[model samples]
Target: MCEEATRRQVGICLLCGLPGAGKSTLGRSFSATILRQRFAVITYDKIITAEAFHLALQDELDQSREIPPSSALLKTQETSQWKQHRQYLLEYLEHLIVALLNSSELRPPEGKCDGTWYRFVDCLEEQGLISSAGSSTEKGTHSVIIPENDEVCLVLDDNFYYQSMRYEVYQLARKYSLGFCQIYLHCPVESCVLRNKGRPVSIAEDTIRLMDKKIQKPNPEKNSWEQNSLVLDSSQLIKADDHRIVKLVNQAMANPLRPLQENLEIKEKDRAITAASILHQADQSIRRCISETMRRVKGTASAHEMKVAAQELQSAKSQFLEDLRERLCEKGIQPMTACNATTIVSLFKEQTDHIVQPFLATEQSCCLEPNLDCNDRASGIS
Candidate 1:
């Protein structure tokens, strides 16, 4: 999968952290202030914008600008488009990694030689976003501060919230025989929200809380990327050319990263089975909650009782997600993607009408048959 290379020091350096946790700030400072411009940055926002253009084109094919309903056809098409887009980005990033190592091979994935990928590559060349192609040892800009070599640090600036996303980048590093390191900026949810508020385009506070709940911390026991990572407290103001920032630059440059070894790899089918089993267990829990709520409320239940029962159902669903992640670890599988997890949760919700219809009917019965025995009512509801 990789050619022989003289350089393992020049490769992907992922800047991972929560939103407003100072990753973008650190990336800029490390490249411009610490290392003095011997690096190329590829931001995730531009990658998303590049792919969004193609999605915008899809509506034109139908000759209507109106947004479609959440139909199965639309979901399938969107999934396909994203899968292709991910592949294109991987190929593009891989090319940059190769160019950094001073390797001679430069071939884009077939069909991407002309489309969005081509234009993006040209833009990189024109703006010096990526290193000059083939001439790997050449100086990109007049930098008297940095060393002269084929090594140009590549900064992957993004909100890599999931371990799966980080793992994907780590796999790319291994695939091309290049050194890899991660800078995980750790800031509390409260701190990040406060900082985010100061931004011109602030994200919703609820969205930040939800991410705080879902974001997986780096675990060195499992992932190789975690071993060579830096967990920085980004809650404070970091000056330009701060010692912490300078130390990271020196680590990536002088100290060649040790080979990051993977202890396990997960397959797709097993992950699917894990997902299904999780939802099934969650369904059983919801049914139990409904049954228990009926027994407790007896023949005096109200909307409040129903609401309490619904809240129990939600708790079960959250636990099911946590349980599924642990199961993935035991079974050597990647944790479920956010899209797939949301789809499963939505499917369970679609069944909510059926699930709650019985509960509501029981509530109606409580009012209709006040004289009825509690045990008899519970049995009837069940």
Candidate 2:
């Protein structure tokens, strides 16, 4: 499949972090740089935002105007929104690319997307035919139909504070079998709050405080989505050497994919060994119990006594040994082995105590029931 001529190689880069973490800036720069090298670029947030804007306008018009909005009107509005959104997204993306190119982010300089292609997309967006500077698609969707052989790189920039959204993204990526890397920008809480101070739509300080108290402060461990992330400190970016950020990005991109293979193999081996050990132990315990019971029956003096002794022994085994076995299985150990090792050992210990002190007083005084004394023969004896 990788070698198929018709298959286009697509790369997705996810820029995730707290608000004002430079995700938008960095993503724009990266996309622009890649486009300049003669490659197709897509920005998910920009496209979605355009679609949202279009829908907002459509809804507004639908409410105010008496004429029912045509499918074409709706389509045009969506197209217009996406087109504008993509244009802005691409412009910002170019800014990011320029930064990366000037800095040391990409080493040995990979292939570049020529200016001709980007200029063409710009022209299409300007003409309103494409409705999106990035890619053109049918109404109600972000995907743009392209030639089968087009090589495309997509940059996804969005707020990912919610665990559910992150998981949804993960599932989407897996379903499509997309190759992508996660880039997370870290910023101080104060910095994040300060960056949003003068924005048209600003998050409240109290809300930020609540987020810190309820969301960020509680989890010390990174979630499943953050496991494969490339974390960079945005605070240090301005003061640190330019080469540091470049090196960090390069290192993340260069990480080997072989680790996943090794991890799977190790897990499989561990499971097999655990299963075998538990099964073996259970078998041994069962055999030992049978042998001991047979020996006891042979030494019993009368048929009636033998029957009672057998019943008591069976009851004890069932109560303690069987229960222990069940517990071991529940704990993920082999049921038989766990029961035999633990229950058999305990039972053996109890039996040995009885044998070692056969002459000791077998009865003791009871406190609960006046009619049921421990010395009563009806209470049963060893």
Candidate 3:
């Protein structure tokens, strides 16, 4: 293992926009002109090669025994395969970042990493970030080193049409306590389609139009996590000399995000309190219904008969509470507001009536029987 590398302030900058919105062009221009530090534009399109996507699609097809012969279904599968490639690219970037942070040799990813991983490593090597230096001491692995004192900002160039896609990058930044920022290239759908047409390998115009509808432009006011973001109109020429871009990068690097900390003790305590409140509500409702039933039958029945009925109701209440507790534990107790009193009272009344019905029937039978002694009837003898 290498000694700890210089703890420089590393940051991740995301270039997001629809295809042919000039994200890659802007990244190139920025990397060439940005001063005092190295910038590596990790383009997703290059990493997720055509061959890799074909294999992914093949795997998806192989997993399904029968795929319906529908263009829409095939398109959905293609999108899913593309997303898998995107995820793998993110993992590759994360692995690189981990190696840099730990000052360790760049080990190949374990378990099911395909050719794309090697291509990604080769891309970094080409940029002079990592190099081949395997020794006899280390067998069957690549030994690479990050250059000293190079505060590299990894500029991720991708068509992040969904906010969720960008959030995944932000989460990675937070996990490693790295500075993060987003740059969104805003271009009209028509202009993007026109620009895409000029390229040798063009994306479908319909796909770009679909992405335009789905794309979520970063709004700092709406999302606190996206405060370190900038939107540039790609219709106009964008240059690295732009002061706003410079300021945004500098500000993000200055302030790295802290990971969120969860307090399990507090959460458990809250759940316990909620469960207790629900149980208490249920108990009170059952007791109130039992008392009402006893009061309604008080004029016709003896004190001893009322005591018998009360015992039966109490037993049913205990069983109901036990079942309620078990339910809460299984499903997680809901909030206090969700525990409606009227609903609880109605349920308790229904169950309580069922429990007390037999006692009422016995009393009625005793009264209707001729030859039954008055003292025996008062005693509630059946």
Candidate 4:
């Protein structure tokens, strides 16, 4: 069908990485390169920024009523409002993308205008974000129309890892029969932290630390999606004179379907690994907690407390065994002998030292700092 063929011609490329990982920069460069060959590019960041700007303006308008009239207050209010307005604009752009994905009939609003692009500016002006429709329409009138016969290459330079958005992107690509490729810009945590320090927009250190912790832990559910990924070490590129990012981009563009298929497989594996790791980690934590309780209860421990601790430990042991069995089954590892709870617990215990060592070290580190702080702070307070 003509409709199916049109959908097949649409291509989407996703650039994903931590903030300041060069996702936007690489996306822009790739867009420019592709544009030279006469391809259309649509960036998620540009759309989101426009929405953020509009939301900022609305926020300002809401605050203006509460503040007494003063030059400083007025200026501050105006700035806040402008920021809100920018957010709204970005949101509108997001909505536009969603609309386009949902219906083949949609086109960029600015592209639809037949008169001078100034007509598009007038439309935005009617929304009241801009003071006057500037005569020089060169700045704000850039728009692209999806042609009936032309192939479109869409470059998304935004955080596509968010569950809802990622799913939307995936579904859109499939629905449109678009070839999709995701380029993951992998950066070292230390390097990312250093880069964030110099940037105006930065994720907080604590947030980054939490992200690091999450990254280090494996989740079985995530294995299903990890198969479809290509990782590029941005940290290595940061030191190079001329990074071969373009080469990678070209390779991705050349074989989009292969990478997408591979990504799907990788995702499955990642999910299985992650699920196994979670079960293991949770069991270790539970055991450690029970051990500590046992120590505290040494001589005068209540019967109820001892019973609860034992129950907790038993629950963790049971769950860990269950998870391990599930993983073995998933991997097609048939048990020659039946795996009972006792056998499973004994098997896990044999591997406990290796699994629990890192956790023990982490626990020690956590306790060391807390003890030090308590002693010093308590002394000072007294």
Q: How far is candidate 4 from the true structure (C-alpha RMSD, Å)?
A: 19.7
lDDT of 3 by residue, 149-242 (tens): 6666789988776688899999999998888999999999899999999988677676577667667889899999999999999997797658
Give the Cα-based TM-score of candidate 1 against the true structure: 0.51
TM-scores for every predicted model? 0.51, 0.38, 0.64, 0.39
Q: What stretches of model 2 exceed 4 Å from their correct place?
A: 1-6, 34-151, 214-227, 236-382
TM-score-best of 1 and 4 = 1
RMSD of 2: 17.2
Whole-model Cα lDDT of every candidate shown, in order: 0.58, 0.45, 0.72, 0.46
In candidate 4, clashing pairs total 56
Candidate 4 per-residue lDDT, tens place, 36-154, comes to 12233444433334434333333333342354466445466556654443344333444334433433322334433333223333433433323333323433332223344444455
Candidates 1 and 2: which is better by TM-score? Answer: 1
Is 1 or 2 the stronger prediction by lDDT? 1
Error of 2 at 228 (Å): 3.1
How displaced is residue 281 in candidate 2, in Å?
Answer: 29
Sorted by TM-score, highest first, which candidate order results? 3, 1, 4, 2
Off by over 4 Å in 4: 1-3, 6-8, 34-143, 146-150, 161-164, 215-228, 238-382
The lDDT-based order of candidates, best leading, equals 3, 1, 4, 2
Best candidate per TM-score, number? 3
